[model samples]
Target: MTIAVLAVQGAFIEHEKKLEHLGADCIELRRAEDLNQHYDGIVLPGGESTVQGKLMKELGMFDIIKSQIKNSMPVLATCAGMILLADKLEAESKVHLQTIPMTVKRNAYGRQLGSFHTNATIKGIGEVPMTFIRAPYVSQVSDEVEILSVVEERIVAVRYQKQIALAFHPELDNDLRIHEMFLSLCK
Candidate 1:
C-alpha cells in the first residue's frame, strides 16, 4: 500500500518511518501538487495544529485533502491531526478540516510539562503504549463517531468512517499494531 504523509510541518518524518517499516510506500506531501499522486491513504502526524492548518491553506492542499476525506479516503490522524479533523474546538472558533464530527479541546493536558506516556486498550487493538505531548482530547463526538480508547476518563481516540483519529502519538511508541491497523484500512 502507498500512503501520503503531510510533511509541510510537524512530526511527519516519524510517521513516514513507521509506515515504511510496515512495508508501505510513503510519499512526503510537501506541496499541493504532491496530492496528485496515487496513494491509498494519508497520515496526519502530531504537530502544531495552527501552523499545519495555515500552511496547508497557503499551499492549497487543505481543500483537496478535505474533499478526499469527505469522499472516504482512509486517514490516520494523531495529536494536532485530530484537531484538524475535528468539526469544532472547545476553545477556538476556527475549525480545520471538519471531517470528523467531534469537538476537541486543544492542549487539554496543560503545557509541554503535561506530556506523558501510558498504555490503553484500543477497540480492535488491545493495550498499547500511548505517548501524549501537549495532546488534545475529544470532549464530544456525534452519534456516528466511534470511541476507540479512553484514558483517565478522557476520550483520546475515535474512529469515523475510514478515518482513525487519536490524541496520542502512536509513532512515538515501539508498538506497530496501531500503524498496522491504519495500513489495513488502505486495503
Candidate 2:
C-alpha cells in the first residue's frame, strides 16, 4: 500500500523509513499537488503544531487533507499531529484539522527539557517503547474515541474511527508494531 507522509515539517522522514521497512510505498507530501497522487493512508508526524498548521494553510493543503480525513481516510497522527486532529485545545483557540472528537493539551509535559522515553502498554499492541518530545496528551475524548494507551494516568493514545492519534512518537523507537497496525488499518 502507498502512504503519504506530511513532510512540511517534523519527524516525517522517520515515519517514512519505518513504513518502507514494513514494505509500504511512501510519498512525501511536500506541496498541495502532492495530495493529488493516490495514497492508501497518511502519516502526520510529530512537529511544531502551530507551524505545521500555518504552513498547511499557506500551501492551500489544509482543507483538502481535512476533507480526506473527514471522508474516513486512514490517518496516523503523532505528537503535534494529534494536536491537529483534536477538535479542541485546552488552552489554544485555533484548531487545525479538527477531525477527531477529542481535546488535547499541547506541551503538557513542559518544554524540550520535559522530553522522555518509556515503555507502555498500548491496548492492542502490548508493551512498546514510547518517546515523548514536547508531547500533548488527550485531556478528554468523545464516546466514539477509544483509549488505546495511558501513561502516568494521562491519555497518550486514542483511536477515533480510522484515525489513530498518539502523544508519543512511535517512529523514534525501534518497534514497528505501531506502523504495522496502521498499515493493517490501511489495508
Candidate 3:
C-alpha cells in the first residue's frame, strides 16, 4: 500500500520510516497539490500543533486534507495531528480544524519533560508500548467515534470510521502493529 505522510514540519519522517519498514511505499506530502496524487492512506505525525497549522495554511494544504477526509480517506493523526483532526480544541481559538467530532486539549500530558511511555491495551493492537510526548487528550468524543486506547483514564486513541486520531506517537515505538492496523483500514 502507498501511504503519504504529511511533511510540512513534524516527526513525519518517523512515520515514513515505520511504513517503509512495514514494506509499504511511503510518500512525503508538502503541498495541497500533493494530496491530488493517489494513496491508500495518510499519516499526520507528531509535532507542534500551532506551527503545523500555520504551515498547512501557508502551503494551502488545510482544505485539501479536509476534503480528502470528507471522501472517507483513511487518515491516522498523532499528537499535533490529533489537534488538527479534532472538531474542538481548548486554548486554540484561531487554529482549529474541527474535522473529527471530538474536543482535544493540547499538551494535556504536560510539558516536554513530562513525556513518558507506558503499556496500554489498544483495541486492535493489544498491550502495546505507547509514547506520549507533550501529547493532547481527547476530552470527549462523538457517538460515532470508538475509543481505541486510553492513558490515565483519558482517551488517547480514537477512531471515527476510517479516521484514526491518536494523542500518542505510535511511530516513535518500534512496534508496527498500529501502523499495520492503519494499513488495514486502507481501501
Candidate 4:
C-alpha cells in the first residue's frame, strides 16, 4: 500500500515513519509534482492547518487533494488536519477543504500549556493512546459523521465515509491500532 503523506508542513516526517513501520510504502508530498505519484491513500499529519492549507494552495496541490478526498480517497487526518477537513469552524470564517460535515473549534484546549495525554476508547477500535497537543475537538458532527472517540465528553475522533479525523495525534504515540485501522481503509 503506497500512501502519500502531505509533507509541506507539520509532522509529516513522523507520519511517514509510522506508515513505513506498518510495511506500507510512504511518499512525502512536498510539491504538486510529488502528488503525481500513484498512492492508495493520504495522511494529513498534525500541524498548523492554516499554514499547510496555504502552502498547498500556493504549491497547486490543494485542489487536487480536495478532489481526491471528495472522490472517496481514504484519509487519516490528525490534529490540525481535522480542522482542514471540517466543513465549518465554531467561530472562524475561513474553511479549508471543507470536505467533512462537521464543526471544529480550534485550540479548544487553551494554549500550548493546555496540551495533554490520555487513553480513550474508539467506538470500533477499542482503547488507544491519544496525545493531544494544542488539539481541536469536534464541536458538532452531522448525521452522516460517526463519532468514534470522545475525551472528556468532547468529540475527539470521528469517521466519515472513508475519511477519519482525530483531534489527538496517534502517530505521536506508540499505539499502531489507529494507524492500522486507517491503512485498513485502503484495502
lDDT of each: 0.96, 0.96, 0.88, 0.94
Candidate 3 residue lDDT tens string, 1-187: 8998989899998898888998889988898788778798988889988898888889998888778888888998999999988988876665556778989998997899989999999997789988999989999988998999888999999999788999888888889999989988985
Give the runs in model 3 whose Cα sits over 4 Å from its true position.
Answer: none
lDDT of 1 by residue, 1-187 (tens): 8999999899999998899998999999988999999999999999999999999999999999999999999999999999999999997899899999999999999999999999989999999999999999999999999999999999999999999999999999899999999999999
Candidate 3 lDDT trough over 10 residues, lowest sum: 90-99
Query: Candidates 2 and 3: which is better by lDDT?
Result: 2
Clashing pairs in 4: none
Model 2, global lDDT: 0.96
Clashes of each: 0, 0, 1, 0
